[model samples]
Target chain A: METLTIQGSPKTPTVEMDAKSGVIEIKGRSIPENSIDFYKPIVEWLDEYASSPSGETTVNIKLEYFNTSSSKCILDVFKKLELVYKKSGEKGVVINWFYEEDDEDMLEAGEDYQSILKIPFKMIELEE
Target chain B: MTFDIEAWYGEINKGDVIVNHKGVITNDLITEILSIVENKLIERKENTRIRKKIYNVMVEALQNLFHHTDKLPNETNDNFGEKFVTFVLKKEKEDKFSYISGNYILKSRVKFLKDRIDQIKYLTHEELQLLYKLILNNNEFSDKGGGGLGLVDIAKRTGNNFEYFFHENKKDHCFFCLKILITN
Candidate 1:
């Protein structure tokens, strides 16, 4: 219903979820000490958003770096969105994964998520 | 058998010392150390790719030390505080950096830790990537919210086997040392 916006910190990323726009963006670093605590609310928000049925949903993930713990939490976020995609006839959701020019690790991270999930991912490379 | 924390600390605090931290490890401390090291890497004019890799590896290393450090054995007479851990980041060469971290672990975990690392040591790059993805997708997280992917991520980025040692202490504790190198 309401937009969920979290400011980015030194150890966490900025998250924005807008129900009206059907867009979710998570950008910046995500290496929190307790990732589940940081991500729990966002996951819950996604759970709530899944029921509303947006016409189209776009997710953008542009992370410079994320720790292993955050990695799992991120996967959870994707899995939740995958459900949203499946429920919306499989064509209403697309994920835009952005990686810096030479960040092979980040690129591969996106690829890993793409392979594991059943959503369409557009690997967009950004020039540094 | 006894392990001397001070002696071991001194031995690893060699080379072009960049960041040498000891005593308690906390979330705020990790943030501060990462900021300091990131600034230092920038000052040294490291390329973006290497800088991010080192930063990523350092996060996992420090957090691993933060989460997995065992309480100091009662018999051990060391001034290192509870949940004590240490890490040294030093410049090994113009295009290389080394990160060495140490912490205590229960003797019971030695075999499991050893076997896990041994299994990761022999994996090729592609195999390591596959393993990392597999573990990432797995929902099994430790009570501390760790997905057990830290070591795999480290090995994958470094492209090097882990250089580690365990020194037995009195009672059921062992001091663990892990060394990782990042190069262009």
Candidate 2:
């Protein structure tokens, strides 16, 4: 599969998806005027990647801030990964959610997704 | 101390204002505002958690202005549709930051806006979450990208009541003012 890399903008996040490394990352801010429009291609890429996912996949969500619209689009990406996880058996998908140590809200935001989805979420804390 | 709404807004935005704008709310302006707000948070040496909360609520607030504001009447009769809005981010105290925004809306929608805000204000934390998820998964984002989630998100993040003021502009239009506080 091809690698997907999207540059970060003031109102959007940087996205990098590498099937060979079995790692996907979304970082920076995501508050696009039309979040669905901005995230459409990424979601589509995930959908395609589902067919030929890696043995062990890792999703790193390092978001500074995302609007409610992007929040839904992100769930859509997670749902795609959930499908890949369910089929991958032992080497399934692992989500890494990073937040600063003092940021309770970001940590809680990750937990919100963890509760909704069936996948395992590794909540990692960074030193401020 | 005498009078003048515009000048009073300047007074409210005084002292450690991270970012402030009072004019047409454009997408580019929203992006610029976020960048300024981000830089302010970083400069304060605050942790990323509160920063994210502050940023998220700020996004909703800006988008609310972008999507819901009514445009001023034009002279060209071209219906250009541009509304003036006010945005302010100020350091309230040691660890608290406040975001204030103002925009114009039709008087007819006042009841709806008030009702929605009041309803969100009264919801418990768990209820806000449930309501958020329910609407999120329901795929209810309107054309402007609002799923009626902005107010709920604001109330939930603040965990405090919102301060608002309504100014009657004309017989049919008025300004909706909002003040949201985020504390670390």
Candidate 3:
């Protein structure tokens, strides 16, 4: 599958998704006015990745902050990944949530996502 | 309640001001203000957790101000112009930060806004978390696409009651104000 790289802006995250490399990274703040509109392309990218099925996919989420509207869009991205994980069989998928060591809120946020999604998230503490 | 915008603005301004922005709020403006406040917070070397909470809730507050601000002009602010919204972040005497936002809102929506605030007023942080999860899991959003988890998340992050007051102005409109505190 083709790679999807959306450079981060002041209000959005830098999204780099290369299905062939099995690397997906979304890092930065998400506070878009129309989060659904901003995330539409990313969601579509994930949809295509689900069918292509890469081996040992790794997803990294390193967001500093996201508005409530973006929260829903972020969840949609995770839901799409869950679909890929469910269908990919033994190829496997590992989700890594990176949080600043001093950031308890981000740590809890990862836990929240893990509770909802079928896949277990690896909460990696970011070194200062 | 008669909400006085001037008095409210004066009250928050008494503190050591961190950010004081008032006027038309646009997407680009929001981004600019966010980065400015973020850099200030980091420069001060505030606690990591508190800074994150403050930053997240501040974004929510700014966006809420931008979206919910009513254009219904009050005779007083009409000449001043701009569907005006005010956001201020100030440092208190202690290690406390105050995030407050003020904007003109329709008198008709006071009850609706009040009901939502009151519903969460008595809820503990854990309960608010449950409500947040329920809202997120249930796929709930309003017709305007605003039935968001913002208030719940704000309350949970701050671990404080959301304080709000409404002042009915002269032009069939009121200024809705929200204040929440963050501790380091």
User: Evaluated with TM-score, which candidate comes out highest?
Assistant: 1
By TM-score, the better pick of 1 and 2 is 1
lDDT of 3 by residue, B36-90 (tens): 8889988988777667777888888887777788886445565446678887898
Tell me the tens digit of each residue's lDDT in model 1 across B1-184: 4778788889988779989998888888999999999999999888988899889999999998988999875556467768888889998898788999888899999999999999999999999999999999879889977889999999999996469999986477888999999986
TM-score of chain B of each: 0.95, 0.89, 0.90
Which order, best to worst by lDDT?
A: 1, 2, 3
Off by over 4 Å in 3: B1-3, B74-77, B142-147
lDDT of 2 by residue, A1-128 (tens): 88999999877899999988889999988888788888898989888889988889999999877888888888889989999999896468899999877777778778888888888999998886
Give the per-residue lDDT digits (tens) of candidate 2, residues B34-132. Answer: 878889889888776677778888888888999999876665213224777788888888778888888778888999998888878888999988877
Q: Which ten residues in a row have the lowest lDDT in candidate 3 chain A?
A: A84-93
DockQ of each model vs. true complex? 0.90, 0.61, 0.60
Query: Any runs in candidate 1 off by more than 4 Å, and if so which?
Result: B74-77
CA-lDDT, candidates in order: 0.90, 0.82, 0.81
Q: Name the candidate that leads on DockQ.
A: 1
Report, to 2 decimal places, the DockQ of model 1.
0.90
Q: Which candidate, 2 or 3, would have the higher DockQ against the true structure?
A: 2
